[model samples]
Target: TLPVLAEPRAAQDLGDWLRELQAFNLSAREHAHTPLSDIQRWGGQAGQRLFDSILVFENFPLEDALASAGRSGLRFETQGSTGLTEYEMDVEVSLRQTLRLSFTYMRRAFDAEQVAAICAQMMALLGAMGTSPAQTVGSLSLLGPDEQAALLALGQG
Candidate 1:
């Protein structure tokens, strides 16, 4: 889990946005369960595990939104590994359903393009919210041996 910043305001104000958030979370979760057009969309076991983890938490019993909800939230990120590159995202756990958005950054390095996309996704939680954009800190190392070869093949293609 990302270290909780413990914004006293987040506790107070987060409840502030629960009504709208619950609706969005419901819609996002529905989209998640729909059949995938592509096989890669299933992402095998690791991706399945992440999705399963987020689903264990159910929305509050209310058909209406929970104004003071316990856990509707989400987490998403981009990463790389072995022979395949993948993107993963899921809604967070919540008393009400949550929307987690995660994705893999496919490449040797994470860059501004990736950061921008993430920022846009965060804004989705609340129609009105603040943002502290990030700057990529340092150089990145090579991809794993298999991924490197795949990239090389793509470049040559």
Candidate 2:
């Protein structure tokens, strides 16, 4: 069975997790979209607040690579998040020899096996990063899967 963190079983911890989830989204989006050079220009942060908590596997963009492929061409994309940050990914398919083709995608690959491997790896890293139930600080119940999903999206899960 997939290992799961039981809900915090405390209201205060859940509340803290919620707030952290929100902040995580804001920071993640800012980090994901801004290019490395621009990030260098901005002192490494855009000073935005995190938004949502849920990490709905989603898409971002395939502008640069797809544009190189030209219009009316095939393009594949995928999306995922660490417990702290969200990401958009594209698959690069290439043929090395007449009978050999290979694919490399860093985000959530359209390929199921790749996706599973990366997701598991990401979740493990998230755990290593100390992103479990946070201090709640209020009267509330334990955070649910819904909240946990959000927390995971923040690159904090």
Clashes of each: 24, 16
lDDT of 1 by residue, 20-117 (tens): 45666565664665554332355553323232112124345333344334246633333554422233323333443544333334354456586455
Q: Pick by lDDT: which candidate is best?
A: 2
- What lDDT does the true structure give each of the candidates? 0.39, 0.43
Model 1 off-target regions past 4 Å?
A: 1-18, 38-85, 88-104, 108-157
Off by over 4 Å in 2: 1-14, 26-31, 44-157
Q: Per-residue lDDT for 53-94 in model 2, tens only?
A: 223332323345566666657665646634332333322222
Poorest 10 consecutive residues by lDDT, candidate 1: 132-141
RMSD of 2: 15.6
Clashes of 2: 16
Please estimate how well model 1 matches the true structure, expressed as its whole-model Cα lDDT. 0.39
